[model samples]
Target chain A: MKKLSLAEHSVRELNSALHDPQAMDGGTEWYVSDPDGRHALACGLNDELQVTIDGHAGYYCAGMNQHATVVVNGTVGVGVAENMMSGLVRVRGNASQSAGATGHGGLLVIEGNASARCGISMKGIDIVVGGDVGHMSAFMGQAGRLVVCGDAGEAFGDSIYEARLYVRGQVESLGADCIEKPMRDEHREELRGLLAHAGMDFDPSEFRRYGSARELYNFHVDNAGIEQGDSHE
Target chain B: MCGIVGLYLKDPSLEPRLGELFEPMLLAMADRGPDSAGFAIYGDEVPSDQLKFTLQSAEPGYDWEGLVTAMERDLGGQLDWFRNATAVVIKTDSGEERVREWLAGNAPAVSLMSVGHSIEILKGVGHPRLVADRFSLSGMQGSHIIGHTRMATESAVSMEGSHPFTTGLDLCLVHNGSLSNHNRLRLELERQGMTFETENDSEVAAAYLTWKLREGETLTQALESAIQDLDGFYTFTIGTRDGFAVLRDPIACKPAVLAETDAYVAMASEYRALARLPGISGARVWEPEPGRVYVWENAQQASEETGT
Candidate 1:
């Protein structure tokens, strides 16, 4: 296995080097020394490459990613794996704002607390935050699963769509268009799989699932007045 | 574009220490304006004792060196270059009188604007971190700071092209919203020989305000002029060396949230940004009224100057 040291290379050059087919074939494992705790490491990858960031990262690390496995050994900044379409990103420490925002596919597993607006506008990404989440988590979320093992702040799952939210601890409040739902056997099994993959051993039965009630998805002519009431209510 | 942030303590406010924390706060808005970031820190340094000047030529190759040399000969050792650029900055000890004399001597080709000391500016390119690291921004101490985060939709990003542009030494400006009538204003400014550095709408606002100030309009008068002339969904925060002002276009397409406390005043592109400040916990926060020009000297002197 070859090793590519990003100690000297800029973020652009480091990502570009990883994309080269020849560099990938050499079994190169990239690492950074003067990581400078920058953001957007290994972002937008589409190949089956394996990348590892050795230290703390700033915002949007591994964002909009696909077909790659990226691992961060330290804390991550905002929007990790945002809009991801495929592959996996594993964070070993706390994540900042809007982790996994608008991700359409793939999985993001954070081992620590996530800041406000986690999984906002998420499409299909499966996000597992091992610790607490700040306010406005899952805001305007469209689809996917947000699994939280700890407490949630205010406005959890506001304006949720088809996305599922599973929380083991207390929830401050639900946002607009969000309500609790029964976690069926299939959900339990899926949650189990995610836990095992993320190396967590929590019980799925203790978690609660929240999703959209489908009350605000489409406009109805017959219910126009009711919709207006809901708008202000 | 780049992200910009600033804080100010208008008079009668005792939280003058808030100006010391400008760097860390502005760093958070980096994503909005990653192309370049800078702040004009207005400290206890009073503008009354100094002359503040800013210059831009209507023609590109106007003789900046010749103008500087002549101003130096006139003002002598009383002159200080607070900031030197392809344009220029020269402070005269004679205050506004020396500045007016110098301006009166220059040709119409050498467009210049000067005012009482009250403005400061900081700028550079790249992400907020890059700009902060390059400038060691966190250490700055000032009475206020204003900033912008750029996405570069309209102009090629560069240090000169970046914003928080000054009309005079005392007044600095930052913008977030886009202007629709930029082309028309750009043409007008161009025909007037305001050699524009970039195709950014923000630049038009800067030049237009400068032109208005050159025409002897006060800060408030110049802003009212902007409300009349500039079109589009724009929001801007203007910081003079002594005071600060906010304006939103009639449509209010952009987001700007302000939080005021006895200690300091803060504003940002989103409520989330303003809510995240450290000492501003529980600060009374609200979005600026659409189409209104909100002015403040600090926490104590805030008022709605205009509205729809």
Candidate 2:
């Protein structure tokens, strides 16, 4: 096990050491203490290493991970696990905005509430929140799945595309072109697997699925005519 | 982008260390806004019968004592004054309107930063750390304080463009986002006889709040109207004589984190600002909801209220 204290080491030194093959080959397990809400800790990891942050982190913690698993014992700031290609990042406490934003592939589990724009613009990430999510949770999400075990804030998924959303609690409102869909047996099975993997005990049958209505995939001719008329005027 | 930080002590025992605890929070946001910085401290309030005014001058070695002597001669009262860098704080029994009229006529080079019993605002065009040090912010003793670090998105990087703008007596505001409809609102507010000191959008916000309060709206009511009347992205931390309040726009594109312990309630643009506070590890931390008003007041008894 490798131990790192953020109090004594800069984030650059810690990230550089994590990136070095010689330094990482000695141990796959890493411990980071006293993160003190510093930004961009343990980012851009490609190897299959297990890293744990013992305290709260600042923005973009563990971002762009390819094959590593990172866990934060406390809350995280904005854009945690943003644009990750693969691997897992779990947060034991609440998360600020845009968690798992624009990620291509990853499994990000937040055991506490996630604020606005969780899974925003995500491509293939799977996010499971143990608590409520703020407004615009999955705004413009191109593809992937977001599971919320607690209540969701306003505009659950705004202008979404192809992404599936499962919530076990009440949704304040849904965004444009997003509607609640039927919960099929396959979806239940998928939720079951995700919940089991994330170590959540909730039953899959209690969740409802939401997805895009596909109405915004193309521009309407009526709107084009209206635009032409307005331009002529 | 800009950064806003506020600390309101619920436990009166922490009042003496208010500036010491808030300095790091403001410093942590240096990267967010490197152009200019300011802070408003609610401390050492004068008696209710008197008022305190914070004034600043850009000229080097400005005659603050001479200005105080002139004010004393005109207002017919002894004015106690102190200086911090280029700024001077004066306590007087004169009327606010009379003092303004006197300053406008006699002190053309000086600018009124704030006028209240408790609030004293100090801001300048420089890094936040330097501004904090210049004002001896870490040594300030207060019940609450709000600070802003400006990146100069909608306004120039001048002393007048900096934040912690005074809204009314014992009230100041620091903002973290730009206002889009400030020009129109400024016109409307000017028509209502509200004066403005800068072209900065945040000053417009402060003036708007002042107008609302003058029209008999409560602070929460004024902020609720701000959500409708103001157009832009903003996360504002307002420091009042009693305590402080936090509000975010409906879209909430700008980030705001709030943490509360038994001792104090802290709001910062990011968690990094609050991470170093004592008992922060045990604080009940969360994000303030969008378009909601969260106020922590220490009047008579400490109380927190959330309103939408």
Candidate 3:
């Protein structure tokens, strides 16, 4: 395992080394220390490397990852793993807002609570939260699955599409066009697979599913004033 | 975007080093808001008979001593004063209304920054580090401090546009978001007899709180009212004589992180500002919920009804 100290190397230098093909040829495992809540640490990685951050990280930590497995032992600021295409980012502590935002494909596991807008506008990324998620989690999510072992905050899955949500605890409120559906065998199997992947040991039957109501998929003339003339006929 | 940082010392031992600890927190947020900076520090309360006024002048080398002498002679009372760069903190036995009138009439260039028994506000237009250094913020001793670094999205870059606006006696507020309905609200507040020092939306928010408090509402209740009346996104950290409170809009578009240790309670726009605090790794760190008021007061000043 190769060790890097953020106190000695700037974030740019460390990421440059991580991004260099020659420098990464001999090492697949890396350890970083003294993160000290610095922004953009080890971001934009494209290799299949396993990196462990020993301390807290600032905003956009491990963002835009392609094939790397990044682990944060401490908390993270806003937008951790934002816009990722593929990879695994695990936050050992709580995460600020917009975690896994707009990720097309990947797996993001937050061992602690995630603040607002977690998995917002996600395309295909799978997110599993061990604790509660704040307001507007998964807002306008397009695809993928989100599992919350703990309670979900206000407006869970607002204006969502295709993305599936499973919550074991209470949801404060549902957003516009979002409603809960019955959990079937297939959903339970999916939840079981996600929980197993996230290293959680909860009963799949204890969760409820939520998704879009499909009412917003088409434009209705009755909702607009253009249909008022037709109503006279 | 702007940055807001606040430190409320729960342990008395950290009082003397408050400024030393807070300077780095403010500097950490310099990138968020580089236009201007300001802070309100609650420290060294005067006797009940005296009131402390924090005054500022646009001129860096204003004649504070002569103004103090003139005020003492005109008000017929002895006044104690301390000067820090362009700002001055004066403790006088005069009434709030009389002192405000005297300053308005006698020293038009000198603006009243705050009026309270313990709060002293200092702000200027410049980089946060330079503003902090000009006011010797690193040497200030206080029980609690609220600071803001402004990027000037809603208003021009000026001293008056800076944050930590005085809400009432020993009460101040620092905001991290914009208010949409400030113009209409400002006019309404003016009709109701509330005066404003700037066209900044944040000042309207401060005045709105001052109005609510004047109408017999507690700080929490006033913030609860703000959730209904105020429009737009915001994460506000308000400093009171006893402690400080934090509130965010229901949508919570603005970011706010809160960490509490046995020694202090710290709130900032981001977690990086709170990273350098002592024992922060073990502190109970969490994000303040949307539209909820979170207040932390000094243990000695905390009453039964104000228990968190």
Candidate 4:
């Protein structure tokens, strides 16, 4: 594996190297040391490569990723794996807001808590948070699946559409149009497979599902406010 | 865009190195804001009822020598004064109203920065590094410090427009986002007899908190009121006599991260500003939740006061 120390190299150089597959032809792999919490590290990657960040990262780490398996051994700042298209991005520690926002594909596994707006406006990404997520998570998310192993913050799944939310813990509140739905066998199987993939021991039976009630998709003159919701749980 | 960084030392052993550690935290945000920079250092308690006030003037031709001696003679109090670049610190046991009347009646051109038992605010219009050097912020020692680097949105790039806005004793606020309801709120606050230093929305935010706290609201309670009354996407760190606090708007569009360890409680616009701090690797790092207040008081002082 290739080794680059952020202390000696700028974050730009690391990203440039990752973008070009030829520079990584030896193995398409890199081990980044001493990240020291820099922003936009390993961003805009589109190749099938293995990149390991050994320490903490700052904003937008591995953002806009495509077909890259990026791993961080320490905590991540805002928007880790934001707008990813494919492959896997995992954080060993906590993540900040907007993780996997507007992402079209791929899987984001955060072993620790993610702050507000995790999986916000998500398109097709699969997100698994091992700990609590802050408020407004999955806001207006159109597609994909979000599985939370711990409690969720206020207004969870606000104004969501299509995306499936599976939480094994308490949800503080639901947002406009979001509602608790019966956990069917299909969703349980999907969530179970995801837990197995993340190497977590969890019982699918302990999880509940939430989604859009589909009442306010279009302007129904009856629904004339922002506090609209039909949550059962 | 704006950048804010704060360091509140939980360990007394790190008190002397406050400025040394805070400089890099402020400078790392050079990209977030390049127009101006500022910091509020809380230290050197007066050990009495006397209050310290930091004042500044933009006119290089302004006379600090004439102003200090004349102000002393005018007030006829035991005034202690000194100069640091364009800033002056005046300490007196006199009341704030008396000093205010004196400044208005005497040095109209000079602007007041802060008034507190221990806090000293120094700010200017320049790059973060240059501003820090110009004000000599690298050598000061304090128990806790709050700073800002500003990219102007609603105000000009003057020293007055720079952040770490202080309106109350031992109270200052640095903001990372704009407020949409500032004009209305400013007018409402003005009706309440609160004067403003600049047209900056952040000043309104600071003043609002100051007003709330002055009316017997705790820092957390005042921030809770802000979450309801203020309309915008903002992340604010407020410096107080006891400690500092972090808060964000309910929507939480603006970015803010906080990390706390046994040694310190630090907050920054991004994790990069906090990466270099001691023991941050093992710190309990997380984003300040939307509409929630996270406050860290000096451990030793709190324990002493509580007799714990």
TM-score of each: 0.53, 0.94, 0.94, 0.92
For residues B36-65, could you state the per-residue lDDT of candidate 2 as single tens digits?
999999889899889999999999689888
Per-residue C-alpha lDDT of model 1 across residues B137-214, encoded as one tens digit per residue: 565555677777677776777666667776455677888867889899889977876656567788788878877877
Q: Model 3, A56: alpha-carbon shift in Å?
A: 2.0
Which is the winner by DockQ between candidate 1 and candidate 3? Answer: 3
Sorted by DockQ (best first), the order is 2, 4, 3, 1
lDDT per residue as tens, model 4, B1-308: 88999999888889889999999999999889999999999987775679898999989778988988887877787888888888988889887888988898898988989999989999999999998997788787989999999999888999999989988889999999999999999999999888897899999999999899888987767777888889987999988876888888877788888888988889999888998898888898877667776766655322111000
lDDT (0-100) at residue B143 of candidate 4? 91
DockQ in order: 0.03, 0.70, 0.63, 0.66
**Candidate 2: chain B TM-score against the reference chain B:** 0.96
Docking class of 4: medium
iRMSD in angstroms, per model: 11.2, 0.8, 1.4, 1.2
Which 10-residue span in candidate 1 chain B carries the lowest summed lDDT? Answer: B11-20
Predicted complex 3: CAPRI docking category: medium
Best candidate, DockQ-wise?
A: 2
Per-residue accuracy of model 3 over B173-269 as CA lDDT, tens digit each: 9999999999999999999899888889988898899999899988778888898899998999998889788888888889888888889989888
- Model 3 per-residue lDDT tens digits across residues A1-233: 88999989999989998999965677799999989789998899999999999988889999999999999999998999999899899999999899999999889999999989999999999999999999899999999999999999888999998899999999989998899999999999999999999998999999999999878844344565555458554
Ordering by TM-score: 2, 3, 4, 1
> In candidate 1, residue A132 scores what lDDT?
89
* Candidate 4 lDDT, A108-135, residue by residue in tens: 9999999889999999999999999988
Which of candidates 3 and 4 is the stronger one according to TM-score? 3
